[model samples]
Target: MGLKYKYESTSRRDTKELARNVRPGDRLYVIHDVSQVVAPLEDAQLYSEFIVTKDKAPFTGTPMVCSASAHRQVGGTSVTSLLVRYGEVYTERPVGIRNIAEEPPLLPEFQHLAARVAREHAADVAVARSEAASSGRRRWF
Candidate 1:
């Protein structure tokens, strides 16, 4: 079974409602445009196509505006009912479809963290080696 999707236009409140339903490990793929839609990558084998609107948007560098990044047990089958959890009126519709990455991009902060860790490890090893040489003991493990 391929991935299943439900398209809808969501406001900030609607987005929050959706986010609340997400569990700790469900993957939510969000496609953003003038309107936005979210697809939960859960139970694709029992998936059904939900057709609410037909539209398209420009394909830019990143198609995602938000992601739940976790699994959720939502309590509705229709877009209207799903978004209505937070009393939001469904007004937006799906614009277009695109592929989202399985892994998050390696942000600059993470890169910096990796570099710092490597540097610190190297420094610790150097200190250990110096202390060993200064003494009459030498061991390489």
Candidate 2:
């Protein structure tokens, strides 16, 4: 079995060449203006808060700070091309890797707030799971 690729333009050969030339550790930046996007995975998390930083440091000399971009230890060049379709740029310099520390202590107020948020989310998930189970849908839990 082979992975399928969707061509973005008439130049399918050129696109294939571009994907072939991509290598591991090739740094890329998201250029898509996500100002209007509401999804957290792409907007609040990946492009804005997670993708551009590791261990609290920026990938390079850039202004915007993003987080949670690297969902895995290794990503493919195909992902880079996919992002390019949405206006991202590949950098010549390889991305620097850093070690992330375990969760540190927070202020008492913050801890309380975190606990509340966790409880609320758990309740929401439980409700959703119950609804799904009753409806004979797939059990997400």
Instruction: State, as a TM-score between 0 and 1, how close model 2 is to the true structure.
Output: 0.29
Query: Each candidate's TM vs. the true structure?
Result: 0.26, 0.29
CA lDDT, candidate 2, residue 42: 30
- Prediction 2 global C-alpha lDDT: 0.41
- Using alpha carbons, what is the TM-score of model 1? 0.26
The runs of at least 3 residues in candidate 2 whose Cα sits more than 4 Å from the true structure, single-residue gaps closed, are: 1-100, 139-141
1-141 in candidate 2: lDDT tens per residue?
Answer: 222223233465534543444343334343334343563323321222123222221342122223235556432224334444544333332133221322334657688899999999999999999899899997765
Scored by lDDT, model 1 comes in at 0.39
Give the residue spans of candidate 1 off by over 4 A. 1-105
Q: Per-residue lDDT for 12-51 in model 1, tens only?
A: 5444444333333333333323222343432221211222
Clashes of 1: 6
